[model samples]
Target: MSSAKYHQIKDHILTQIRSGQWQEFQRVPSENQLAQQFAVSRMTARRALSELTDAGILTRTQGLGSFVASFKSQSSLLEIRNIADEVRERNHSYSCAPVTLESIDAVAPIAIALGVEPGEQVYHSVLVHFENDAPLQVEERFVNPELAPNYLQQDFHTLTPHEYLSQVAPLTEARHTVEAITPNQQMCTWLNLYNEEPCLQVIRRTWSQRGIVSFARLVSPGSKYRLGGHLTFTKRS
Candidate 1:
């Protein structure tokens, strides 16, 4: 059968599963049966099934048939403006745990990122962002003490870092670089990511009118979170 026929049959099967026609843990139609129904070869039907199974949408058992896999994670790539607001907008619960909030001396790399002199004291915070009780992202940040004084006294659990920063210091400009990376031992334990699974890492630096206010390293499970940027072009005459 043609690839078009295979796609059609695959989509039909997916729709059935998604629409609750084939409930979870229920066996999907066999390859031969699906081929007969779609008037295609068994090879074409098998290919569709194999691809879907690889995608984590279907589970196939030897001597049995395919079943729908649960734990479907929804991911969206968006800027880190207000994670709590975004999650609530999507009707998903959002929460955070401030792991460490303290004042620390900036090292060479961190000083450069924060646009500060090396050995300068800065406010540091480690936070874990969550969606519906599942840990989603880990944020390790260093803030300019001049911009955010007495930062450690404030409670981040009640107010997110983004919210507090926006209230005190409106962001003037932001820079970001994203990459796929392997999780370290600490990250694996926090994000619950397997060793072989790739995680998305975003390095962001935000500047206020005063100067660079903060530099943050954001790490999220690739399977559960996605980062995205939006842009609009302007014409110059």
Candidate 2:
């Protein structure tokens, strides 16, 4: 079969899945049925389904036929929002204190997150965000130098790192992991917390069209901060 025929078959299946005609975990037509409908050989139909399965759009079982893959749940914390804007929107005064901003050699962990080699120079910044004179968040971010060449030159106090990076390289994707931890001595001092105080930590990695944009560790005193969002769940039809 011609490559175009296989792709056409793939596109047809994709259109059905994308349009919600085929719901998550809903069984798809077998290769024989697809071949008969598309007037193609089983190999051609199988190629289409195999490609979709490889791309995470479909799942196939040993005895069962292909089915639409379930979409992964996403947290609103992964959504790109300016921290300064969030504070201001709460009807409180917002301020940022730039604690550290410099070009540094990426450590192993930083390099792995940024998809760069260790010892490569990367832009690093630490800023404390305040709401109504109270420290609300401590942001420690490592930026890919290729994506934001002059990241260190920006005045984070005036324009937040998020704001600046958004202008330079529009975010394409972001991944976040949240956890609770006891604040370290330095973190406590920065956030004005007592010893053994728990904090909510958000570790986020973001990407742009160019490549990995930044990896950030944002910490907030648990007593003063909470993360909440709503997600709609859809049932298979």
Candidate 3:
């Protein structure tokens, strides 16, 4: 099928934002104005606006229209399972849609995450995690070629990265860090985020018995995914 009108309009707005033409927290044009400018249906304009809102690029409220949001931050606490699994344990339905998967040479960031030399070979995958049909997270990940030779051969729609890795590589050690990520236009569109809603980005490196297994960067709606744990101090003699 041809590209959707909303997607085209969304891309245009994102281009403006990336070009610095649309400053942070600034109000975008009204839906009617955008529709007229784009020569699209009002519903099409609405779709574009909705897409931005889901991507955390813009915030929308009842009768308030839409406004841009600042860059988001990523946050993570000690957690062992996928954020989807965490939400599911609370009785909510969690699902994922695998978008793209391919083998590629590792870039600098991927190499760093996988603890490999830059330009090394790796397997890359992009998946969107959803909670009850609403886009919740975007997972961009790389796998060590030596560890997961057939990474792209498996069916990710039926098995999550955590699940697949657990079966093949069984985690032995891991390092996880969190930070804020101001997503690009594509990421925002995939996650259905708003510009105003910052996102939580979790960077995880995992090892198996042999060596580095996988490195994954997980991005999610900050409002939906939160980590909490209780701590206690022990007395020493």
Best by TM-score: 2
lDDT of 3 by residue, 1-237 (tens): 123766777767766766679886788888898888877888889977875664445667668777765542223346577665776887888788999898888654355456577678899899998888889888888899788787899887767888888888887776665666677788889988768478888766677888778867788778877756665669998
Error of model 3, residue 151, in angstroms: 1.6
Q: Is candidate 1 or candidate 2 better by TM-score?
A: 2
Tens-place lDDT per residue, model 1, 35-119, is 9998999999998897666434566777878887542222223455687887788899988998999898875446545666668
When 2 and 3 are scored with TM-score, the better candidate is 2
The global C-alpha lDDT for each of the candidates, from Candidate 1 onward, is: 0.76, 0.82, 0.74
Using all chains and alpha carbons, the TM-scores for the candidates as numbered come to 0.64, 0.66, 0.63
Please estimate how well model 3 matches the true structure, expressed as its whole-model Cα lDDT.
Answer: 0.74
lDDT of 2 by residue, 1-237 (tens): 558888888878866865679898999999999889888999999988976664445777879889886543333344567888898899999999999999999754466567787689999899999999999999999999999998988877789998989999988777666777788789999999866888998877777778888888899999888887656679999
Global fold similarity of model 1 (TM-score): 0.64
Clashes of 1: 0
Per-candidate RMSD, Å: 18.6, 14.7, 11.3
Could you arrange the candidates by TM-score from highest to lowest? 2, 1, 3
Backbone clash total for model 2 is 0
Worst 10 residues of 1 by lDDT: 69-78
Runs of candidate 1 with Cα error greater than 4 angstroms are 1-78, 235-237
